[model samples]
Target: MTGKIYIIGLGPGPAGWLTPEASAALEKVTDLIGYFTYVDRIPPRDGLTIHGSDNRVELDRSRHALQLACEGKIVGVVSGGDPGVFAMAAAVLEALEHGPQEWRALDIEVLPGISAMQAAAARLGAPLGGDFCAISLSDNLKPWSLIERRLQAASDGDFVLALYNPASKARPKQIFDAFALLRKLRPAQTPVAFARAVGRPDERIVLTTLGEADPGVADMSTLVMIGATTTHLIERPEGRPFVLTPRSYEANR
Candidate 1:
């Protein structure tokens, strides 16, 4: 008999953000598979076998999980954000679609968890209150031209943009170039936020405007949110300003 696989998102960083469904699935799984860092997050147990691999081997990890499930071992593929959002759920489904027929028969479930974008937005006050879209700045899987096209369209549409994987050591210049393009389409005073490691101990949130935004402040862990034309800021006397995109657009017209 074939066992099952549950692809779960562990949330942005903290265990508190993990959904009850994801936590329940994790407790039932016999094996866990994911990027080494994510896999290491789960505490070691007597029966659970953890399989950690490199970040670049998503397909390989999916296949391994599938193979394990076929051998009657319940597997959990852990991801950092919501598994359905640019995460392991798609990778696992892609593997099942092309892998052996037996793999297709196995039971698979994808449990949702809080995404980095959601966590970041919560920390800043409701920057996603209005129309919004999320995009990954990492071009490892797709072309940079395509990324630019999407960014342009989103800007033109006045959609609040939640940019994932903004910058890394290797791709240090892309964020600056993106800022330049956004400046052309959006106003200089458009609100921008760089939320890094939300929910983690080292969490940092920087609120600024597009004209004054410092791309150097971003890194791989940062989630950059560019507010729409209607977005506004509420300055507080005690803490950081609250960033929010108003829900009604009729008032702006």
Candidate 2:
């Protein structure tokens, strides 16, 4: 008998952020597969088997999960944030599409959870309250030129930008280059937020303007939000300021 496969999103970091649906799915799976960090988050049980691989081998991990499911083991391919957003769901689907015909007939479900961008937006005020777009700064799978074009288009269209994978040890310069480009396109005073390790123990949220924003504060874990021209901040007496992008654009017209 063919078993099932679930693409589960574990949310950003804290266990509380995990959705009820994803939790329930996790309980049913006989095996879990994912990147080492995310797979390590699951507690070991007697009947459940966990497979952890390197961060860059998403396709191989998906194939292994599919093979296990074909052998009648219920499998869970886990991801940190929402699996559909630059995570394992797409990888699993890609595997299914190219794998043997029997693999296609196996049961598969994608369980959604809170994404990093959403978590970051919540930690701040409502920076994504209006029109917005998310762009992954990592050019491992795609060209940097494409990313630049998308960034320019989003800026020109006045959409709030949620930038993922802003910087890493290997690709540190892209974020700075991106900042330079945004500086040319956007106003100096436009709000920019650096939300790092959000929802985790070491969470840090920094709010600044485009001209004053510091790119060095970001890493692989940070989600950088560049505000539209309409985005602004509200000062509070007690805590950090609130960042907001208005939903209506009547004033701009």
Candidate 2 residue lDDT tens string, 68-155: 9999999999999999998889999999999999998999999998999999999899999899999999999999999999999998
Query: How many residue pairs clash in all the candidates, one count each?
Result: 0, 0
Q: Give candidate 2's total backbone clashes.
A: 0
Model 2, position 111: C-alpha lDDT score: 94
Predict model 2's lDDT versus the native: 0.92
The sequence of per-residue lDDT tens digits that candidate 1 reaches over residues 1-41 is 56999999999978789899988998999999999989888
lDDT of 1: 0.93
User: For candidate 2, what is the TM-score?
Assistant: 0.97
Models 1 onward score TM values of 0.97, 0.97
Where does candidate 2 have its weakest 10-residue lDDT segment? 244-253
Count: clashes, candidate 1: 0
> Pairing residues by index, what is the TM-score of model 1?
0.97
